[model samples]
Target: MNIIHSAVKRVVKKSLIVALGCAAMLSTTAHASEKVYRLKLAETWGPNFPIFGDATKNMAAMAEKMSNGRLKIRIDSANKHKAPLGIFDMVKSGQYDMGHSGSYYWKGKVPNTLYFTSMPFGMTPAEQYAWFYHGGGMDLMEQVYAPHNLLSFPGGNSDIQMGGWFQKEINTVDDLKGLKMRIPGFAGEILAEVGAKPTNIAPGELYTSLERNTIDALEWVGPSLDLRMGFHKIAPYYYTGWHEPGSELQFLVNKRTFERLPEDLQEILRVAMRTAAYDMYTQATHASGKNWSTIQETYPDIKVKDFPPAVLKALRDANDRLLAQHAEKDEQAKAIQQSQADYLKQVRSWTNISHRAYLNSQAQ
Candidate 1:
């Protein structure tokens, strides 16, 4: 009887061990079979649009290559998404995993977002990049985006954007009175304060509006992008930039989607986005210079002009007051505004001594 009981105990223990081993093996197979993660990105631009469109493509490619097919990104343009301005809501709600658009575009939905793009007479590209990466700009940006279940990063820079293509040259402050222009965001508010009637227009309709006298002036991007719009043909006067000196587009990711990514994948995505952004900036710089040269040589009818001293001063003053109002209303806005101002002051001193001085000397 004792021997039979001992044998029964041994058999039960062996069966239990076998079942546990099978469970472990199944777990290993399940993990190994996990499929590659694919994310969908929505962009604000139309298909094949210039530097802006190229940035997303570059990011997608870099991420896929680095991850060896473990991470794949699919992009949907404005035409496919049919919601150029709706990128914010779509990403936040998880309708899309990512988005590419200007940070300022979300100013209406999220006021603090306005400060992330470019400000009137704000820091240049190099200065802004320093602020974003080195100066707490990234943390502040995260703070602003966190509540919406999103993360934001600098997508690219347009360098110094041209002020606008004006049908009539702006010679005096008076020239802005009742001027109907397709200007948006904080800049549009400043223009309104200065007696210009600011309006918003879809990018595709900008040319037809300007040509048919529906709008008097419009600022797209720099020469890299403006030449294709043919704004110079209709509006003979090209103005130097003031509002968006370093227009920075934003890359947005759904926080939930980001959190689910493996650690290696998360790092790969960050590096890819940063590289693509820097590459786009380089591309923009080259394209702007090359296209500007083309305009000078081929489009003799297009005249370049700068805002008069008095008008510039007025713009600066109006912008200051507007920012003051913004800062007063929101504590986050005040903090971001001050941080950017402080960072710009520190960097501009060096910029003035180096790039500015060198360029000024070259012009002589």
Candidate 2:
């Protein structure tokens, strides 16, 4: 009996030591793993530049919250960085750990980057979101940006943008000839193809240029943002959107910075970005609706118009030709273009049945 009791005591002693040691190891691990990661993000917007700037702030807030303050993102707006359109180069070169900008803005550096943003008469926000999350868009984006050691995610949606504020009526295709307009990206290429002189103008200069007749027309974002820009005050014509049906802004990350993060932190950042992007869409839609109501009530004389069918056909043709040229140049561009076209066909069918049908009935 004495020998058995002694053996039990020894066993208890060993178990206690093992438990204590495990506890100490766990405490040390918890301490060591709590290291904070701080990152700097550059944005292609002025300080507090409404929707665009709000997205960056929203993403940073979400990342910090999700990681319990372990991951903090510092955002530098164009006002601070003095480079509104330099977000891609800044993030790629590690001058900034991340960026908030539109994908098509990098077309000069990487031609295929244009498709990731919205195309003229392309998918709406819902359809595009489906494409990005499910229809193999994320994988295709990986292929495009991997070479640059960068990553791109949909940062936000500006919603369907206004086609432009035209000073005079565009009744026919001939109206576009020599018509100077401020339209950028692949859409600008389309405008040029349609015989319009498409130019890129900085946001700060857009109002003054339009006021001075430096531009006959300019396509900015929709009513949500345009209201504050006072475009309606100067221009009487508020045309419907065809150029940027759903412009998806982008969140770019330095590949090295992304990979070095802890697996959990990486996920935190990813979720934060995605959530913020979707949130921006909702915000934009809401703001557009509210602001449009105000614009109509305040400026009842504003002419809301659509491009003539002939003009649309010309623009559409120009867009198709451009895409064909793009596809012929690169196999990857061909694949991306095909993917978008195929996805749009599939999703638009449902959209017609759901949103279009419902809205039409309500209008009736």
For model 1, give the RMSD to the true fold: 3.4
Lowest lDDT block of 10, candidate 1: 27-36
Number of the top-ranking candidate, with TM-score as the measure? 2
Instruction: Write down the TM-score of every candidate.
Output: 0.92, 0.93
Off by over 4 Å in 1: 1-34
Model 1 misses residue 249 by how many Å? Answer: 0.6
What tens digits encode model 1's per-residue C-alpha lDDT throughout 25-134? Answer: 99997676455899999998999888999999999999999988889999999999999989999999999999999988888799889888888899899999989999
- lDDT by candidate, in order shown: 0.92, 0.92
lDDT of 1: 0.92
lDDT of 2 at 8: 100
